[model samples]
Target: MFERFNLSEETLKALRKKGYRKPTPVQEKAVPLLLEGRDLVGQAQTGTGKTAAFGLPAVELVDPSRGEVQVLVLVPTRELAIQVAKEVGELGRERGVKVLALYGGKPVAGQVELLRRLRPQVVVGTPGRIRDLLERGVLDLSKVRFFVLDEADRMLDMGFIDDIEFIHSKTPPRKQTALFSATLPEEIRPVIKRFLRPDHGEVRIEPEKPTAEKVSQTVYRVREEELFDTFLRKLEETPFRKAIVFTQTKVEADELARRLRRAGFRAEAIHGDHSQTRRERVLRDFRRGRIDLLVATDVAARGLDISGVDAVFNYKLPLDAESYVHRIGRTGRAGREGVALSFSSDREDDRLQRVRKVAGDAFRFVNLSDRPVESGGRRPSSGGRFKKTFGGRKGKGTFGRRRSFGNPSGGG
Candidate 1:
């Protein structure tokens, strides 16, 4: 129970109210050390509850009466900054701890006004915005007691190392530091050494599989010209409450969303090219079910945490295995069953093989190019082979060789 962590009653009460019962692996390991004021590094995925892992400690350590920013969290994207700020705000609500989110896209003047007016105890923001604020002398980090770098690898990938370094330099060296990432590569080692204490605590939670266990993955080989038509047919044949279609480029995402809308489907596209207001509006609609299908590129969809996505479609296959896993991971969240469909062309066979190597028995390959397309295709019967493929049941052909995709009884 959270009480075992010996957190304040207010924090514990907030946790209970939020419906968080037991600590996840990351939380169980990192929470205690963070409470002890130890510098730490955690290796975990997006849905592993890492936010609460560090957030609980941050809330407990900050002094609400100080009326100054005591905790600073740096993330890779604007979406993540908002999410972290909201979560941390909730965690600190019982203690009357004020929280603020600062990021680019939104007007910086408003953020500066909030910083001076609210006197927030916790601030979450992107590296660029935080650096910008620091340069403008509006964001005060000298009083920041806790520094957190979330998704360090992604920040490095986005070439935010210099800005991260600048932000880190602004904070006091004695502050408690924590870094979290899904993977720790060599490029991040130097940053870790620079930002963290020499003897920082480390927590690594190895995932059971490269992708979510409840997600059924399938690959369909089709000719390049027929890919979109096959995708439409699949959409007609499958039933999903909500789905996200991933494209390789922002242009592709926009075009696909337009095509889907023309075909009488509720669809919207989100990418970096879109303004921040528009992106948030589209995401809001998607979450409220106003939009049933969302077309997104890899970067735009990164670090997004949306629920009830029952299906994911790869209109264009990602070049790497990691991107493929992340794309399919959009569905099958929180143990809900989901389906991931990918369209591969003849030239993309090599890319498909790489994904297969990473996904193991969880991936099923089927040839849909030979199948005749019918007008207004009917849903596959529950007991039919097509349905069986995604229902965790063994079917003829490729499905027979693999164990049930989502069935826990069928051992990996």
Candidate 2:
């Protein structure tokens, strides 16, 4: 499919080197239109190669001879900025097109200095940092011919619309723009209208497919008090090469990681409070299999693209239906079969119903004790035994004897 696109010789060579033999569905549709200098709005889910879908064509059009920022890619998070820049840089390496990732956590002076020295042809960054540089008169967008909003919906969720609009105002009016989002909410329509031309091309790829079909989803009806024990039992019994456990808050993520480590699992936690350096290190270890498990909050794990994750465990239920989809999406990538196990306690029945309504019977309910144990020990499936060990009410129970379920100190 890549052969069909009118990609330049340099990009073609890069694609070949990267072993990109065929185009993903989104890439197949968006690459051709983007290469034709047409603006686009791509509606596709994460892990669908949305980065390369737009990055390839953006690189193919760069005039490497001129040392000007011709392309600007806006992402929601710094991690995504680095990830996108890495992929785009690799594709544009033969052309010697400079690529820079600019984000807030790092020093402003450093990015400003680099912008002055390199005048990078492609800049991938968060909306806030991009706007800051634009106001400081350090980053120039007058020569920018291509603009991309990667994870547009996430940017909206983060309340970066004003910053995106301000940064977009700095770019030339004739430049081509592309907004790629997993799910397009009604709120984004105004922003799209303001930034993109009315005649922009639209590419919708499986917009209704909220979750990957390859993933086998299941729900474990474990009580709140036995959440960790059930999770631990599943971990001990199941065969997971790599797994990600999602929590609702940073505190929960940290507490869960600590618990997992105490249980002798190679675990690490990432959240909004962690420094960029630490987060990068943790993600690197997770990707290289140095860490067997990663516990993270929703914001920390958004746009994360690591393959070979065999399972995903919901340490705690997510607040929204969309978040549940994104959390489970961490696994079942690259045409591989994966498992997603969510724990639905009685207290979370309302949220569970909401998820069921939105997800539409995607998950099969299963009891943890019913699953076959990979090891020799008997599976911990008896609710009576669980109640005896935990010593609490059936419907409302706490992990620790002195604390309640809602107490943050207990970390339940």
Candidate 3:
């Protein structure tokens, strides 16, 4: 916890102003080692205060008087670049450290001007844009002392491996490096071997399937035609203060939000194509309770830290079970109980079963679409049975196994 650590008064005051009472588990373990100059490979899920675990120490290392870039944080998406940079800036505000965020989809000329004028002490950016700036010789990394790769797994999934390697290649080998991810697949081995130091500190937390534990997860079986009606009835019946509806694609997200608005529901759609300014406005409205429901695609919802989200609706099942976990995790955070309702048709039975296998006893199966079943006129066994599709016993709740790399940087 921050109470135990001996940080400077300015940093401590900044944390207190932000109402940070104690350190998260990740911060407790990684802060001391990071301050000691040991490289780290931290494995933890989103919303676990990872930014502060690395950000505070990074801030402490900054020498504002040096007037050059000392810390570089590479993230997967523009949204994340903005989010991480904002948090870092807040933590270092009292120390007079200038933090800048660089990402694609914005004006590169403006970024070049900022770099030339501010000479930011810290830079957080997406790999592609950062690479572009490096190629153009507009941003300098020759003096960077701390390098961080946040969301390493997501960067690889988004096909930024080559760009990430190129960016790392430009930094001096002696710079402290850290790689943090929700999951570490075997494919990351070569990158870890090539980048992290041999004796880097490793702090891994067992990933928690919070959807089952913190949220009441329920699955409703309905025909494709009845899906919308079922979702509408569920929304009408539940007192959801704020909710997020997940769709498979941007078009679907936009269309659904339109339908919801036409039906007298306050909703907005967010996707990759939305301009950054519009996205920020939508998020601000959602946070301020001006908008009650937000419909979003999976990619658009990444790196969002929204509070007071009472429920989550999976309008369309995700393509993968891992994505299901991430979607439902949107709610049920910060010690609050949340509700997750999923509408599944027979065609989506396979996907639902896959989610169940990973979700275990946390998921409760129910058939709410049948009229007779809802009216208590039909027996629970008589309605469409999602369990029948399983055809056999459950798999004892074992889904994808979580791997532990004690010291991945220890190369052969």
The candidate maximizing lDDT is: 1
Higher-scoring candidate on lDDT, 2 or 3: 3
lDDT of model 2, residue 299: 68
lDDT of 1 by residue, 245-354 (tens): 99987889899999988877888998867766788899999888788889998767777778888789999678877778778888887767788988887456666666
Candidate 1's TM-score reads 0.69
Full ranking by lDDT = 1, 3, 2
Q: Give the clash count for each candidate.
A: 0, 0, 0
Give the Å error, residue 237, model 1. 5.9
Give candidate 2's error at residue 310 in angstroms: 7.1
Query: Distance (Å) between predicted and true CA of 310, model 3?
Result: 6.7
lDDT of 2: 0.79
In model 3, the Cα lDDT at residue 183 comes to 66
**Per-model lDDT:** 0.82, 0.79, 0.80
What order do candidates take by TM-score, descending?
A: 1, 2, 3
Alpha-carbon TM-score of each model against the true structure: 0.69, 0.67, 0.66
- Clashing pairs in model 2? none
